[model samples]
Target: MSAPEPVVVVGAGPVGLSAALAAHALGLRPLLLEARTRTAERPGSRAVFVHRATLDRLDAVRPGLGTEIAARGLVWDTRRTLWAGRQVHLRTYPADPATAPFTSLPQTVVEDLLRRACDEAGVRTLWGDPVREAVPSSEGVRLRTASGAVHGARHVIAADGARSAVREAVGIGLDGSTSATEFVVVDVADGERPARPERVFHYRHPAAGGRHVLLVPFQGGWRVDVQCRPGDDARHLAATAREWLPAVLPQVPGPEVTWSSVYRFQLRVAARFADATGRVLLTGEAAHLLPPFGARGMNSGVGDAVAAARAVRDDAVEAYARERRTAAERNVRAAGAALDHLLAPRPGLRLLQRSAAVAAPLWPRAGRWLDAAPYGPRIRKVRY
Candidate 1:
């Protein structure tokens, strides 16, 4: 058949926007469709970390977009880890102004920047018109919107998030597992930056009844993740943040909670990244749902976005399906390892952690390991 033309992208999220931008850079006309309007109220500070490679990908698609994000977000150079109120690790690195390792900002803010870039690039986005159905054939695909309007395209990139209608229409299924333990995440707006200005992780924090808590700084506030035991009530913990949060961080008493969520982390990946006809491809959360431990969720989605666009541009849709699914599987493995270490430490790992904490005072490597263990193993770079 003729080469796919007038590429259609489902969803106006960061990944979808990136796909459109990448398509534009590759000289393909793209039409973006989103269910939400421009003024939708997206609440929470979801996906706060953006890796350097993701920024590079965005900058390659549209110059200076990455720089803009870095400027708007905070970059913490210091990392601190504590075990039962005793400091196990404290290290700081020199800053590099040329290129930041990552940027910490709210997902909404990043989406805004991406949408702005789309506007500047003249990418047409049809808002409030979500794709309700997708039918693919040997030649092309046809999409039916929420308003019952039908649109035809040579190819479709589905990035409409976890509950993707397009994915169901294409008969693709997700395979993986979710944890039973719940994690409560809270976003607090801080009037001023904390004195430490570092990313901190606690193992059995004394103030929070020996539960693990992670404190990370974003552009305008802090994200606190509290790991709840199986019997513990995560929703109650989030609901009572005003009372208990101060104990976790004495520095920020009476914190202004902007958003909170109780998450049952999952490591699911789509069974197939593309439809049988190769006229529809999945990207971002539509393809995978990773635990947020190592910040692999959106970063991997961004990678999928650019790769999907390039695959369509080069007429290598099958290759894209295989490679991206492999990447997602690797991400799921890495994230699973991290989750196992953090939430489900076995007896052996528990002993190792305790020993590491005790030896950290004298052995620097032990301290470093304690600081880095929660993030799990890093994967080799894969081209998007």
Candidate 2:
């Protein structure tokens, strides 16, 4: 077959936008299509933590973007754990400055930055235009948009997210399983500031049954995430913060809730990174999904965009499929392990929790190893 046409990237989320930016940097005029009229302005905070490796990757595209983000977001240097009726404070592992330390910035802000960067790079971002159909051709891939406009591209990228329309149209099977656990995440306007402002608190109520709550500081107040218990009432699960906050964190005053969302844990991966025709490719949630733990979901997606951009730029579609599919599988397994470790039954995890608590304070270095080990030296380097 002749060389594929220009690359078309579906979805305008962070991953899609980043891929567009990367492709533009590589001298490819990528067309970015977004079904939504505008980028997400969701009130609730989604991802706050930016690992050092991701920072390095961002820096490759723009010199000061990562540093500016670090300045805007809060720095979390400590972690507090509530275990067995006792509050244990531990110094969290510090990120390597040379590699890029972990930083906490809202997902909206990050997307906005990427969108702006894409604009500057001359990428065509067509909002309100969704790819309704994708037909692979010898010349390139032809896409039919919702607006009845037809576009042709040498390659197509599916970054449309977990329920990707492009992936379905390409006939790529999403291979993976979903867990029964449900989680509620809320961004509250609570005026109460954490006493220890520089730390993230994981409150485990001894008497609150098996449910767990994680509280992290955000721009206005705290972002609270609670896990739903098995067979819990939906109504009660939805309105859990008001009822459980007092039991979870007795120190804070109630604040107005700004936004709330519930998500079920799903672990999914595409059967193949590229379609049978080899023109359509999947990235981000379109390729795989993982529960939000250790902030791996977003980071892994960002990594996918970076890798996909490299593949497109080099005209190495097959290599891109091989590398990214492997990476997605690895991230899926890592996220599953993290979820199991965090949400395991109290009795079953008590010993492991105790060990972490003890090791964190005693060796300090052990904490750093755990935090940074997942992102090894190989993954830190910018491939493109």
Candidate 3:
């Protein structure tokens, strides 16, 4: 009797963990490899929003995994949009009885839950073993780790993020454009008083020198994104958040920043999601990179992980490559549109935004447009 095929998953982020669990459920032996140790510090409240579709994918891997995550995150019922210190739109919906539409929690917490799921499934994980080289043949993939150890995998699922060693080793390249706007993202601890659990987006904040700012509530804190104009110093802005943040967010009293960083986001997709031998498949940020405007990055990556596992189990790499790349393209386009709307780079777009703001008081539809435009035609448009 032959042994069960071995599917090796690279990286130990949410995506890799999801892939490992999915593979195990699909009756395949899975091995997970992480460059970082178990105690590595994962900084920042990255990828706070987890969509319902993402939860559905995780549930398919394990019966109660999605429920565990949903229960642990925040589900804000209010969404507000403002223009130049004036509220343009405000909408609140009643919470669902059975399940929330989505959940907001730190990516670190999600990863912790995913890691726990992997452990429960008895998935083998090797820490501190980064893959330095990956050579694929018609039969399988040969992976050499930083520890000078070689691993032969029946199939390799690459979820090592944008700077993926496995993707590079397989000779896949990402192609897309980057935003001109420098964005400063910060996570702040929950403050005292008046700061309601809601999501707010301000176009041209009056208090912050007319820059754009978005405040989203999560489990224990808020993830804030401030868009910087040309020549603005992101580092300087992040350093002095306490000063300007208070003025912009009067609802929060003396909010303390937990994490802050500058980012010039990219919209990219891999040329191919699989190698020529069909022995290596890319998932998560390894296959695509989208701006965080629509919360498309991590959510879409989860979908990729589940699909990749199914492909490996069914021996249908080419089909996986085609379908996932198509999904990546749609997500890139949607995120790009959202970014463009937020930046308003051209005179026409700026004029349109100003016109919409002026008309918002008289026309509710205009306000709704302003509120929804930043999220890019809803997730159904992408159909991922």
Candidate 4:
């Protein structure tokens, strides 16, 4: 028998796992190398939204996978913005039964599901085996792991995330700047349920100089994300939490904190999706990163994985680079715009926010446009 078709995937995060799954579905035996020993077990919540387009893609690869995830996750249909004591409910688009609905699930749960799917598909997974170096040649790419074992593959996919070692080794520069705003994410047990279970809760402190806090109900609790302004001490995360929640979420009693993390927002995109050698390709955070404002980061990466896998299967790597690069750039732009609009400091911005709130009910079309436009790209199934 001939040697097995070689494809190596670095990183086993959701994006990495999805890429591996996509490759496996396309009849390629992929070797997935992950630095971490296992999937995350903690309660930290990140990237909770998955779009309808992604669900369709997942369904096509492994039937009922999207439905399985949805059964375990929550469907968030409405978005609201809060200012002082006032709440503005935004308009929502009707769900299309033909396409899957947009759903919110914890990152850990999604990764776990993908891991199980990979196992069932017989994809080779190497844990704690960090790729030390990746060298490309005329024939194929050679990877040396930390344990000194060398492996060769016809193609290498770098899904290792923002601090991608594969991108560094191949010398691809990321283009973008980190934002000034920092966010603190705190997860706590659900002390009480909200009156409205299906809507995302947003609270802006008018007296606190426009500081905003968002309470997203997930699993058995809520994920609290607070925007921190300049000159704020990172150590004051807990104090900020206590001060903000009582005013924002009056219904839920104070919760026992579970996990908290501070992240600085950054928007970046790879200068090139493929390395100079053309044997190595970048996907997920390896290719792009967006501010977490609109949940476009993971959605964009998953789309990249799907497109890249299909391109490789059809021997259209160049087309993969072009398509993914365009998509990444579009997401970066949308994420930046959303962040700017949400975090605006001027009186004009306050006016805009207030206007958006007041007009949402009168002109529901405009409200739906603003609320769904940023995330709309993720739902579009682009042909590679």
**TM-score of each predicted structure versus truth:** 0.96, 0.85, 0.97, 0.87
Which regions in candidate 4 have their CA more than 4 angstroms from the true location? 1-5, 39-43, 90-100, 192-195, 200-203, 206-209, 238-244, 345-347, 354-384
Q: What is the lDDT of residue 265 in candidate 4?
A: 72
Task: Write one digit per residue (lDDT tens) for candidate 1, span 2-22.
Answer: 344569999988899999999
Local distance difference test scores for all models: 0.87, 0.70, 0.88, 0.73
lDDT of 3 by residue, 1-384 (tens): 133248999999999999998999998879899999999999999899888988888998998899889989988899999999999999999655237778889999999999999988899999988999998998788888998988888899999999999999989999998887899998889875536788899998999899989988888888889999889988999999988888876677888889999998799999999999999999999999988765788988888899999999888999999999999999987887788778787899889889999999999988988997667555455744
Which residue pairs clash within candidate 4?
none
Q: lDDT score of model 2?
A: 0.70
Cα distance off (Å), candidate 4, residue 352: 3.3
State candidate 3's TM-score: 0.97
Worst 10 residues of 2 by lDDT: 373-382
Candidate 2 has what TM-score? 0.85
The alpha-carbon deviation from the true structure for residue 180 of candidate 4, after best TM-score superposition, in angstroms, is 0.6
lDDT tens digits, residue span 156-219, model 4: 8889989999999989989998877778787766675544434443435564445667667665
Residue lDDT tens for model 2, 149-255: 88888888888998898999888888888777777777665454554444444535464665566767644456667777778764566676676666654545665
Q: What is the lDDT of candidate 4?
A: 0.73
For lDDT, the strongest prediction is 3
| 1 Cα displacement, candidate 1 (Å) | 20
